[model samples]
Target: MKGKVLSLGAAALLAGGALLLTGTANQSNAQDLLGVSFIDNVKPYLEFRPRYEYVDQEKTGKKDANALTIRTKIGVNIGTVLGVQGLSATLEAIDVSALIDQYDPQRTKYETVKDPANTRITQAYLAYKYSNFVFIAGRKYVAIDDHRFIGTVNWRQMPQSLGVVAVAGKPIQGLDFLLAGVYERKGIVDSLNKDWKMDKMPIVLDVNYQVVPQALRLKGFAYLLTDIHNTYGIKASGKIGLGNGVTVSYLGEYAKQTDPYQKDNVATKPDIDTDYYRLKVGASAMGFFGNVMYTYFGNAGGKDAGFSTPLATLHKFDGWADVMLSGAAKGFYYGMKEWCISAGYKNPVIGKLMIAYLKFDSDKDPGFGKSIGSEVDLLYAKKLTKRLSFLAKAAYYNADNGYCISECNNKEDALGKNDVTKYWLQLDYKY
Candidate 1:
């Protein structure tokens, strides 16, 4: 596999130069012979990304997906450790390569650039902290809240990790808390399906407070995915500052889904009731920003099931032309609903700009028809220095005709009248 990822990137650059020369030659008796504080509390991490992606679809002559990819990540982090004062440790690795794979990482059929080159071990953890607690176990990267249900999809090119055990705490003032336990997951195509992992023993809970710190916040969550589903949620976010330089922001959310231990599966007969909602409002000043959003999933638990997240980060929610990322399906009925409007601007000499508009529909009523399409997204970013960066992106969808009667029934005359386009270009570097 590419020479075992170049021999683990030459053993992580020789273990970061032997932890920076053993912490600068034992900066003084190596903490009384390694009781910890080794190698000056090590830290070394790097990242590189190169991407080019393009895809066009409307079915018909089928053949449009161009990809060129590269992603690499390496890591190290160690703190206190051995002497164990709130110990810590971390290790990371990731590699995805393809210099032109012409798209299809739907895991198999060899080359369709779903960015699948592979080399894993995304993160290894061990953590501990006192005074307001913290603890973690192995395998890492997890996101809650904004990730929508759980995340770490890191925008693809291999980013999904889990095998958790976690904890977090904050005993007072502006509360905060978290708890987690997961068995395994490791998908972003688990480098081409090792059955795409997933072993389930899920459990998660999160809580947040911060009443007015950043201008208000509140949150709550629950996951629990053992015999399949369970999701719970609440959220409220805020920001407000209105005076010449305007600022206003808001977010609202709610969630519900059921069927966990109350299980019943005749091998895939799922119907985990549902409900989900989201709302957003925004404003910013000088460097401009704007937003309007709405989302709803709900399917009242009919056609098999509907509200789902399957580990979010679903291409940052609905419109990236990922076609509702599992929401608007029409075989066993799925649900989808969305609306978005965004605008942005940031300029340090003309650097960032963004625009978004999306719309999609269908939330039960699957006898086909609920206009499911409309999208337009664009972005540009720049920062070419101090760690390098540049990016350009695009997406266009446009499907409607009720998205070919809810997604091409019987191939809808050979793939429902096309209309989906995408493009991306990127470069990033970090250390």
Candidate 2:
């Protein structure tokens, strides 16, 4: 009975198009086009990136988590395919490895890390575009504006994508539409039951139009979701620019999800309705920096208006540590919520350095007097060259309760002194 679960919707389409992308798919098209391809309209480019990290996971029994990742991408955008074409492929192949023997000599006291690395083909797809429309088939990428909902699994050693056929068209001015028919079959190993009865059928429909394009900078959106897990939601966002580089942005969402039933047609008791909203405003002076953000989650999880489903993108608003996707994937998080205020200074005049700071606060659980969590973060990234860089980050969390979840938890140290520290460095290359 212990196995994995995969969701396959009726139309069977999986998401890979990025509207708000994280770091990985930055160089999607072809800026590195060579000779004739640039002139003949067949653009070709390549990228090679290598990342190395060392983490000290206090609860894993081991003293460190060290590994190396090598990412390679070679793609071509052909102007004419069989005498007719306009499309491209971004990433071709990638591999990850753990160099267990290469322990840092400066830190002789630490233990060796394990080899938990993996390898796989990340992206391989073809695209076709005509004046006001775009079409993609095979394995590609997807991220919806800030990764609020579905995004490419770029954080994994071997992320996931679908065998998809999608289309984008502007049906009218100020209005656009997207539709796709995705492949639904799963590999036997990935399909928990190996029955392949098509476990997921997701039909996504989203539209955003400039509501106030002139005097006020604002927009409205409607998202319709249907399938394996029956549900739908509405979201809207707007921004106002105060004079002199200052601005405010607000976002809100409400989703009502029914239950995923077993064969008996029995509905899971107390289906939940969830709502989340965030309002943040900040100012910019050159690249020197500033920001303030506040987010709130509903109080109850099992009933209506509370917790959100797992694998759903919450990092759309906050930073991506993926620390929140824990729990029953259906339970409520205690406390009102939290706020984050961050600011930073990029490369200094005297030294080549970048540093940032984050201040956090804890909110008391709905009806209780006890606080949940509070923390601080210090991050720095330095460029060795335009193509290579290194990063060092630290986090400090002060929590009074047992902060435990399925992915990451603060349960190992029940003494409440569950403070944590983490740091890492990496080298990158892009072409």
Candidate 3:
């Protein structure tokens, strides 16, 4: 797999170089030597990232994971093709290779780490833009409304992309709108599950309105995953200046989920009737910032099935430990709730430093206990050069006694009698 990835990377580099040379050679003539128009706008980009991750869990006999991996992406964008205005195309390829395969990708027998070795076309799309509207078709990344319900999942090596037709525009002043119909979703586990082929139309709609410029914003969305579930939500967020160097920001969101078409067919699956809400407030001054947030996933009449964000960029929401990425309502009879507090500092000399603490609890009694666990996260990031950066991060999760018996459903669950710790060091370069 390593050799294959290296070979592909080399081939892509050569191809990109040839394209650059061809474009340069065609500058003399209005048309290229191959009879292609020289007017086409071309932009090429490359990215390389190498990361080392270590995971330690409490489960006995469960080996710890230490993984070293690299991710490479090469792509090009072509604009104004065929002398047509508002027409463009993009093609990109991605490769993730393992340097030391000490972790399980769910497809292997080692300890799980989620990141896998794979190669695939991450993005290929055609787009047209006219006036204030843009239309896109093909496979691409999608994210909506803070990514609480939908996102590209870019934190992972593979990320996630969707096959869809999408449209976006500012139809009116202070208002922006987006709509998409997804036919398939290629997830981070594409190499393991292939793409999730939707049997029905999965439609998404998002709208945002600037009520008071930068001081206030209102947003709404509706995501319908046919034959699966539908989500409708609204959000309000804003920032206010408080004289001096201090500023205050607040966000509130509410969403409801319901069963999709053919609700009766899947009798074994719990009915989809739940609600999700989040509230956040923050203050920033000088180089310091602090925030407090609370999130709730309402129980559906005490059923184990709670609010689920099947399409969300889970890692970003729940703690960085990724314990609740699958939805906090998993094992408990009631839903799940979380509270988080975070603070950060930034300076030219030290880059940026951040720390966060999170507490998890069950919304209702589950016989054993209501407290689930707590996690602490720390991160440091520095930009070494124009196209290079370094990052070091860590997460420590301490489980309550009840966490292991209830929330720990899989062998990979970090929740156990003892604490779980994970560390990562990464370097990134983009051009």
lDDT of 1 by residue, 226-327 (tens): 655788888889888989999999999898877764332235525567778889999989999989999887764443566677778878877775766655
Off by over 4 Å in 3: 1-18, 23-39, 106-109, 191-199, 262-270, 302-304, 328-333, 401-418
Greater TM-score among 2 and 3 belongs to 3
Worst 10 residues of 1 by lDDT: 191-200
TM-score of 2: 0.67
Q: Is candidate 1 or candidate 2 better by lDDT?
A: 1
- Give a tens-digit lDDT track for model 3, residues 1-431: 65766766664544344446655554546454535553367788889999998888776456788899888888778776656788887778888888888888733545578788888787878899999999999888888767778888888888888888889999899999999988777888864223334455578999999999779999999988755577899999999999999999999999988766433234443457778899999999998999999999876553335677777788887688877665542422356788999999988778999999999886865556667788999999999999999999999988874333233333344343356799999999999
TM-score of 1: 0.36
Number of the top-ranking candidate, with lDDT as the measure: 3
Scanning candidate 2 in windows of ten residues, the lowest lDDT window is 1-10
lDDT of each: 0.73, 0.44, 0.77
State the displacement of the C-alpha of residue 231, model 3, in Å, after optimal TM-score superposition. Answer: 0.6
Taking all chains together, the TM-score of candidate 3 against the true structure is 0.89
* Range of the 10 consecutive residues with the lowest summed lDDT in candidate 3: 402-411
In order of appearance, the predictions have TM-scores of 0.36, 0.67, 0.89
